[model samples]
Target: MNTENARSQPPHEPSGCLTGVARGIALVVVLPVRLVWDALAFCLRQLWRWVLAPVGRALGWLIDVLLVTPLRWLWEWVLVPVGRALWWLVDTVLLTPLGWLWRWVLLPVAKGVWWVVDLLLVTPLTWLWRYVLAPVGRAVGAALAWAWHIAGVISRAVGRAVGWVLWNVIGRPLAWTYRVVLTPVGHWLRTWVWAPVAAAARAVRAAAREVRVALFGGSR
Candidate 1:
């Protein structure tokens, strides 16, 4: 009855010797794995706090001391002076002469030429067209209208001849060539050639912008 009662109740705990053997196995296997994990964690923490952090700070300080400060001084002192001198040389040599030519030479000559045209050519032509030519043309037209049927035919023929002359001299072919040839050619050049060149120019400008940012520390 007691055995049956024991079986019905529950299983008993392991003996002390078996428990001792199990603990020994755990010490051999799990103890070393835990020790290795703790050692790795400790090494990583020391490396980050002591070695890597200090090295990063030292590299930053070294870069500031060696490279950045000297470049700034060189840009401020040497490059700025050289640039200013070159600009001054160009202004003195190239621009001053052009300005003098405009102010003293070319300007007076152009003014004189324009005055001559206005006085001799334009004024005379304007007076002739308004007073002489326009009056003669109107008188001739009025006389022809009163003459006969033959005069009407002659006037029509004259009108057609004048129109022919004007069309041949200045109208359709020049307009056609501009529309067909020049416009399309200009469009093609703008699309294929100028577009690519403009894109490359923009890329170069962007690279220059990056250089400026680096040189000026990205502030101004």
Candidate 2:
């Protein structure tokens, strides 16, 4: 009997309170986010349609029709013939003349001048050098060589005598004096002058260390 009563009851529907709460949450969280997204999309669509697309199409048409068409016609009609005419003019006027001058005038003249110089001046000068000046130069060079040898021998003997005198008179006496007298003076200077300076330097360093330790708060 209880089972039959339960089957006979109708299906339950949600309450108004829960449904109102769900609608409130949707308004707070989802509605504002969706509204903002729709506004941004509308703005972007309007920008592309009104501003960017028209400008892009105009620039593309200008580049293709106005600029590229005229350039192609100019290159074919004007530039090709002008370049060929300029090349022909340069070759006919400048290069041909220069080639003729080099082959006929400049080269022949240079060769003739070289031949004359060789025959007149160079051969005579070579003969003079080989026969006349060379023998005289050799004789003078032999005399100079003898004089240089004698001078070198005398110079070496004088240098030896000077060296001997310097060693005996100056160097030996100075060495002996340094060993006997100056050594004691140098030791006295170190013991008195240098030792006091060194001790002062060490004391200053120790004082600086103490000051640094005090400033930094470190153990001694």
State in Å the error of residue 219, model 2: 76
The C-alpha lDDT values of all candidates are 0.92, 0.93
TM-scores of the models, in the order given? 0.45, 0.47
RMSD of candidates 1 onward, in order: 41.8, 21.9
- On a 0 to 100 scale, what is the lDDT of residue 76 in model 1? 97
Lowest lDDT sum, 10 consecutive residues, model 2, at: 6-15
What's the CA error at residue 128 for candidate 1, in Å? 1.2
lDDT per residue, candidate 2, 1-220, as tens digits? 9999878867684688997998899899998899999999999999999989998999999997998888988888889888889989998999999999999999999999999999999999999999999998998999999999999999999999999999999998999899988998999999999999999999999999899999997876
Count of residue pairs whose backbone atoms collide, per candidate: 0, 0
State candidate 1's TM-score. Answer: 0.45
- lDDT tens per residue, model 1, 1-220: 9989878864776888998999999999999899999999999999999999999999988998899988999999999999999999999999999999999999999999999999999999999999999999999988877787777888999999999988888787888889999999999999999999999999999989889989886753
Q: Model 2 misses residue 9 by how many Å?
A: 30
